[model samples]
Target chain A: SQKIEQNSEALNIQEGKTATLTCNYTNYSPAYLQWYRQDPGRGPVFLLLIRENEKEKRKERLKVTFDTTLKQSLFHITASQPADSATYLCALPTDGGSQGNLIFGKGTKLSVKP
Target chain B: DTAVSQTPKYLVTQMGNDKSIKCEQNLGHDTMYWYKQDSKKFLKIMFSYNNKELIINETVPNRFSPKSPDKAHLNLHINSLELGDSAVYFCASSQGQGAWEAFFGQGTRLTVV
Candidate 1:
C-alpha cells in the first residue's frame, strides 16, 4: 500500500524566517505532487503543484521541489509572517497520474510566531 | 461568487441518525470528490464522481452514499451514522479526471454524538 508521511509534530518558526515542511512517500512514484494550505475550521486551499519532470516550482514566497528519486517533496515558505500560520498538506494522485482521486498526507502544522 | 460551496458549515447529530450534506461547484468541472478529514487531520478520499457518474469509490461503508444530480452538484448522505463517522467532510471539484488542481468547499464539520 502507498504511504505518505509528514512531520507529525508542529513546526514553530520565527516570523520572517524560512519554514520548510516535508512530504515523503513510499511504494509509489506519482506523476505530480501538490501542496495545500488549511487554516483552522477551513478546507484546504491549493498552493502549488510540481510535476516529476520539474525539479522546482515557485509562486511568490512559496516554493515546491519534487525529487522522484528520493520520493520526497519539500514545501518552503520564505519571508513567512504570522498570518502564514496554518497546516500544510501534501497530496498526490492515487493512481500515479492525472487522476481525480488524491491521497493527502497527515499535514504539518506550521506556526509562524512573531 | 464562490467557486465551490457546501451548505451547513456545521452539522451535529446523534448516532443512528441520517444526514446529508449538499455541495455545489460553479467551476464547470466534471470531476467531484468527497474527502473525510479525521481528528488526526488526514484527508482521505471517499468518493469521486465524473459527469454525474460514480467513478472512484474508496473502501467506504455502505452507510455512506454520494449522489451527483449533475456535474455541478454532489451530495453526501450518511445513514445510521456511527461515532467514528464524526469528522470534517470536504467537497472538491476539478476540471476533469485529468491533471488539474481541485477547488474545495468550505467543509462541513459533522459531529455524531
Candidate 2:
C-alpha cells in the first residue's frame, strides 16, 4: 500500500525566517507531487507542483523540491509571515489508479510569529 | 466567483440519518473529486468523477455514494451516517484526469451526532 507522511507536529517560526516542511512517501512512484495550504475551517488551496523529472519548482516565496530516490519532497516558505501560518499538505497521484485521485499526506501545521 | 462551491457549509445531524452534500464547479473542468479531512487534519480521497463517469473510488464505504449528473456537478449522499463520519468534506476539480492542480471548494463540515 502507498503511504504519505508529513511532519505531524506544528512548526513555530519567527517572521522573516525560512520554514521548511518535509513530506515522505512509501511504496509508490508518483508522476507528480503537489503542495497545498489550508487555513482553519477552510479547504486547501493549491500552492506548487513538481513532476518526478523536475528537481525543483518555485513560485514567489514558495519552493518545492522532489527527491525520487528518497521518496520525499520538501516545501519551503521564505520570509514567512503570520499570514503564512496554516497547515500545508503534500499530495501525489496514486499508482495504478485514475489520474484524478490524489493521495494526501497528514500535513504539517506551520505557525509564523511576528 | 467561487470556482468550486458546496452547499450546507456546515451539517449537524443524528446518527442513522441520511444527508447529502452538493457540489458544483464552474471552472469547466472535466474531473471532480470528493475528499474527507478527518479530525487529525489528514485528507483522504473518497471518490472521483470525470465527465459524469465514475473514475476513482477509494476504500470508501458503500454508505457513501457520489452522483455526477453532469461535468459540472458531483454530489455525495450518505446513508445511515455514523459518528465516525464526522469530518469535513471537500469538493475539488481539475482541468483533466492527468496530473493537474486542483481547485477546492469551501468544504462542508459534517458532524454526525
Candidate 3:
C-alpha cells in the first residue's frame, strides 16, 4: 500500500530559529507535492507547492523543496515566529492524477517558543 | 466572507441515528470534496464531486452517502452512524480537478455517544 510518512513527534524551536520539516513517501510517483499549515481547532490552509521538475519553491518566508528521486519533500520556515507554530501536513495526489483526490500525511506539529 | 463553509461546526449524536452535514462553497470552483479527520488527526478523503457529479468515491461505507444538489452544494448523509464515525469533517473546493490549491472549511467536529 502507498504511504506518506511525516515526523510524528512535535518539533520545538526558538521563535527566531529556522524550522525544517520532512515528508517521505513510498509507492507513488507524484508530479507535484503540497504543504499545508493547520492550526489547532481549525482546518488546514495551503502553504506552498513544488513540482517534481522544480528544485524548490518559495513564498514569502516559506520554502519547499521536492526531490522525486528521494521520494521526499522538505518544508522550511525561515525566521519563524510564534504565530507560525502549527501542524504542517504534506499531501500528494491520491492516484498521482487529480488534486481533488489528495492523500495527507499524519502531519508534524510545530511549536515555536518565544 | 468565508470561501468554503459547512454547517454545525459541532455535532453530538447518539449511535444508530441518522444525520446530515451541509456544505457550500461560494468560490465557484469546479470540484468539491469531503474529508474526515479522526482523533489521531489523520485526514482522509471520502468523496469528491465535480460539477454536481460524483468523481471520486473512496472505500467509504455505504452508510455514508454524498448528495450534490447543485454545483455549489454537496451534503453528506450518514445513516445508522457508528462510534467510529466520529471525526472532524471538512469541506473543500478547488478551481478544477487538476488544481493543486484547495480552500478548506472550518470543519464540523462530530461526536458520537
Chain A superposition TM-score per model:
0.97, 0.95, 0.96
Find the candidate with the highest DockQ and give its number.
1
B68 Cα displacement, candidate 1 (Å): 0.9
Task: Estimate, for each residue in B7-81, the C-alpha lDDT of model 1 and write its tens digit.
Answer: 899999999999999999998998999999999888999999998889878999999999988889999999999
**Candidate 2: TM of chain A?**
0.95
lDDT of 3 by residue, A44-92 (tens): 9999878779999999999999999899999999999999989999999
Mark the regions of model 3 whose C-alpha exceeds 4 Å error after superposition.
Answer: none
DockQ of every predicted complex: 0.83, 0.72, 0.77
- Tell me the tens digit of each residue's lDDT in model 2 across A1-90: 898889656899999999999999999988889999999888999999898899999999999999999999999999999999999999
**Per-residue lDDT tens digits of candidate 2, residues B1-113?**
99999999999999999999999999999999999999887888899998888977898999999998889999999999999999999999999987789999999999999
Pairwise lDDT winner, candidates 1 and 3: 1
The DockQ of predicted model 2 stands at 0.72
All models, RMSD in angstroms: 1.0, 1.2, 0.9
Give the per-residue lDDT digits (tens) of candidate 1, residues A79-107. Answer: 99999999999999999976758989988
